[model samples]
Target: MNSELKTDRVFLEIFKNRVQAIVEEMANVVLRTGFTAFVKETGDFGTYLLSPQGETFGCPLDTGYNLSLGIPAGDVISSIGQWNEGDIVICNDPYSTGGMATHLPDVYLLKPFFYEGQIIAFGLCFIHSSDVGGKVPGSVSPSSYDIYQEGLRLAPVKLYEAGVLNEAILRIFLDNCRIPDQNWGDLRALMAALNRGERRLQELVERYGISRVESGIEDVLVYAETRVRQMIEDIPDGEYEFWDYIEKGPGGYPVRLRCKMVVRGDGIFLDFKGTDPQVRASFNIPTLNKQGHYYLVPALIRYFRTLDPSIPWNSGMVRMITNDAPSGTLLNPEAPAAIGARAATFIRLMDVLTGTLSQAQENKLPAAGAGQAAIVMLAMTDPVTGGRKVGVVQPICGGSGARPMKDGIDGMDFAVGHLRNIPAETVEADMPILIERYGLLPDSAGAGTYRGGCGIDLQLKVLSPDTVLTARNMERMEFQPWGRLGGKAGAYGTAVKNLGQPSEERTGRIDELLLQPGDTVSFFSQGGGGYGSPYKRSPQAVARDVRNGLVSKDAAYEQYGVVFHESKVDLDATQKRRSAVYGSTDEQQSFHFGSAREQFESIWSDEMQLAIGAALTVYPLALRDYLKRCAMKEIDDRFHRGEQVQAIEVAEIMAAIHRTIAAL
Candidate 1:
């Protein structure tokens, strides 16, 4: 290599490593001094270093999910005035923060990194605080009607001036939050962490010069962009469409999510044009640009890692893809749209994207994983102490979908991985809830030759009255995570409790369910779909899984066509059954859940939900949620008004059309 070129490459690598190490130290600084358990123990925080031009250059990989928050950080910087060196801008407004802090609980701060009287880079950090004062104690709920109901929304304001902490702003924060002491502690920790990040960054500039740091940022992004483009180039370019549904919304109607991608060479355009419009509840996505970042980054990261993990996360990875989601769709909602549970929609978006990419390049992508194992907190006030106690008693998740050559990993965290379930002992000690049961649900995994992962089962009994539970980004209650090949579908999810009688199958939202000492609640999460035909599965493997309680013997017989006799495998009978059911391996039987798919199919189609959701997006929350549930009244009221019929009527029409066509 040429001497000049070699020098530049060496300098770039050194600069990149230095900046990354600085961000790593920044997170450590926050956790060490933070007051809240969420930040100190759970480590629910992130640190990033941004370029001068409002671009995310680097971030700590281990902390936070990915670089999606980078967009919000840049937004914070640009929205604020000409920021000074010591001015630290803080905001948690989903709208004002440019979707950086997705919800209120997450506190985001942006500080300009300066060198010799000029702004060079920005240091950013965000932590999910334990409480922010809302309708619920934790400031999150699936049924939240408005952002105000969620919690305090902070605009971009300097929490610090001339390196002096702004006590007034600090006091205002502590005054509103339920846990004032912990909130103050976490705020100080965030400021301290940013200072550490800034200090380390300055040291790097001193060592390698600012010019080298700038060049390294460009080089790292260029390298990542090239690898991602090459990966996209290998696939046969064409337009592909994939659509999925969410079973648990305001009215429990399936919300249709459609994505049509046009891929030509190294470029791709993702259009959610025909997708359903926004809903009234917390499922709506708040920021357009942020939503785009959230969808593209994770998918590219997953795909690129399959090729090489050495690729740095920068704009280059997502440079090849463009998003075209309209303002009113579920993916991009208007103002006042409740977005606390939007992560659930993102999970389906990732799944739909993966499914689409798989069709284009089968070998490049992994099968669908447990979509989103979201954390649902049930918090209440202690009657005696008058203090708040929160418990993440059940963080529900499904099994990962089966892979090409291997079974899916059980209880996987697909979108973000930093979420760790709080220990039962910690909850009992800190709160009044009793964790009765927390374990994997057997026979819940999708059945195939390579089985999907199994989801978790949780049972909690509330010991205090007036407890509030906020369940966000939770789905798979109706449409289960799908499988590839001939894999059987996994079990659907459920959330119920003991009401008047001991057990009654009840469904729907109970935001403020009054509970006595004996009242018990149970939540069963969904599982991932399997891959390949079950008949082709090895009899020995099935037996082992059955023995381990991962797979039941009945599931083996029903899904895999494998039978065991008195604890031992009936090899002869199993072979005979496999041959009779599956016949020659060459002839692939397309097993149809005529009843299963039809069950959801009868309610709505992708096209209908898109049309209705589009129309409903312009309306207020109550109207949108009403359209989702009591659309029958809407259909009957407007059948002849020349306006388009609702989804319920459309489903009925489609069914009638099918009957007519079948008769012909």
Candidate 2:
């Protein structure tokens, strides 16, 4: 309760924006100095200022990954021994720093800003490393079952001690990584950004005075907390429950994510009690069970910003909200769990959060969109130097869900959308690869009054031998994005090997694929779900989509009942078709999850899944993944034989697996 900040309203607003501008300027410094394509070209980096206590108070508006707006910095701050005048602490271990890094590739650094022999604030910055020491070239693979296999796990330590270089630690890190020189360049870029932020912060303290600057930092937290509470109070106090998944269910469990959001007055409680157990894949999110973790409540944060439009980026926004994502779940796994592909799970968690909150608000949020992204990278050996080289081909971006009044963003989802698309020429220059096709997927979006966004279609050919193609965060292939309010479901993701060739084959999600010279491959991202009924859409709008090559005439006729004759809609025939298909439509349903998911949900009812999910958890962590797959195989056999399963019979199936497998 600083009286200076409490009374001076205009000064507080200026202080907030000034802090943001400093960080924004810090972003430019990193882009100018960063070496890797991920840093300079893709812009997979961020710079911000934190309170002395390590709460993020300022973040850039439109740079880097906005998905990490409320990222926690306190754990990294507390882990280090002490803060000196010119020391920079860095770490990438998710387990040691209380899930501050989440994955190894994302290296985070924190620097304390001091003035007059006292700590004023902290400078925080992070950049995604092209590669750290790991099994794969990119240091990311779905097959990685533990953190050790992912990359070099660094605990919080003094990367820059008293403004002097720590060559001993630097040499060890460089020796472990793939491209030592480029990685070191990126590290220097981060240090430069931190130093730039520190300079601006010193100027801020000089202009505003030490007492006022300190008061402003403390006041922003109180302001953000009060504003968030006011917004949460608007919703009626009730418990709303919703669930979603990552498609790879163990037996029937898949990686199901369930949330029970309880809104009571100004405080919101998120209980993730029914989420599926951690899997063997690199999909776990090590959140350390922190209250209102950034992973658990990203959607809610987006909602708050939408409502207020100027909410402060700090820890106080989460002060009124509490979370209970139980230990052992993917959201809060134990130590050493693989988290290379945790971004995929983080995207799905947003879906579950949006679904839960949509129940409380009437048409507040749009239906789910292509809620995933895959980073396509090509790895090869440089012929001249025989050195390892990896280049990001492109980001497989997806469309957003259709909104109530507007269509979703086509071919670029807001989730991790800040990662820019690399140019075709740049891809060619960096690696021996040829771009065959790169554009939006036609007829991929859901059919609704307001159509969902379209996904990407990228195909490339390798020009060199012994090339490895890796794509991470591939999802939504098994379970397509579901639509709400009588809207139809969107298209599912597709991956193919040698598409349209004599050796054509449909590949699902690719962990890793080695390519030969002249071999071509294709990757298609999923489109977003639509909002409202397709039949109610304007025929002209459907015709526009057809003309733009985003929708075919046949789909326009069948899905939207829009009769297009010679590229022109025949309104009379369209009206008749709509009237004829009225009775059998999805008008009565609140959510249209498409035929595939609908049938899957019908076959594996919630009762059966809950029973099976619980049964699988009883086994040891190492044994559950294997047992679940075996149990699912047995269940699949029963399905093929036309046998129906009840919840009561689940125990018998579990007992059989336990006896046959556990006994051995």
RMSD (CA, Å), each prediction? 5.6, 2.0
Q: What would the TM-scores of all predictions be?
A: 0.88, 0.96
List residue ranges in candidate 1 displaced over 4 A.
1-7, 67-72, 290-292, 383-386, 498-510, 583-597, 607-664
Could you give candidate 1's per-residue lDDT for residues 1-664 as a string of tens digits? 2332323666656766776677778878887887755676566787777777666677776654354523645667777767777998878887876666677887888899899887778887888877888887677677786787887888888888767788888777778777888777787788888888888878777877877766776676666667788877877889888877765565555676778888898887887777766776777776565533654446655776667777666655776777887776677677777776667777888788887777787644555666765566767877679877764554567677777788877776455556655677877777787888888878888877788888777777777877767666667766667777676667777777863355644544445455556567777777777777878889998998899888888888877778899998999999888888885442232222224455655544565555555555555544455544555344534544756655545445434433554588
Clashing pairs in model 1, backbone N/Cα/C closer than 3 A: 399-453
Best TM-score among the predictions, by candidate number: 2
Task: List runs of model 2 lying over 4 Å from the truth.
Answer: 1-7, 249-253, 383-386, 616-618, 639-643
lDDT string, candidate 2, 1-664, tens digits: 3442462778888988888888888888888898888888899988878888777787877677655645667877876777888898878888888877889998888899999989898888888988888988789887788888988888888878888878887887889888788888988888898889989989998988999988888788788888899999999999999888887643334578888999999999999887877888888999888777777777998888888888877667887888898778788888778999898998899888889998898588888889887888878986666767876788787888888888888997756667788888888888877898999999899878899998888899997889998888888997888887877778989899898889898877788898888899888888898898899999999999999999999999898999978868899999999999977876646677777677777766677667777887677777766766676677767887998777777768977988986568
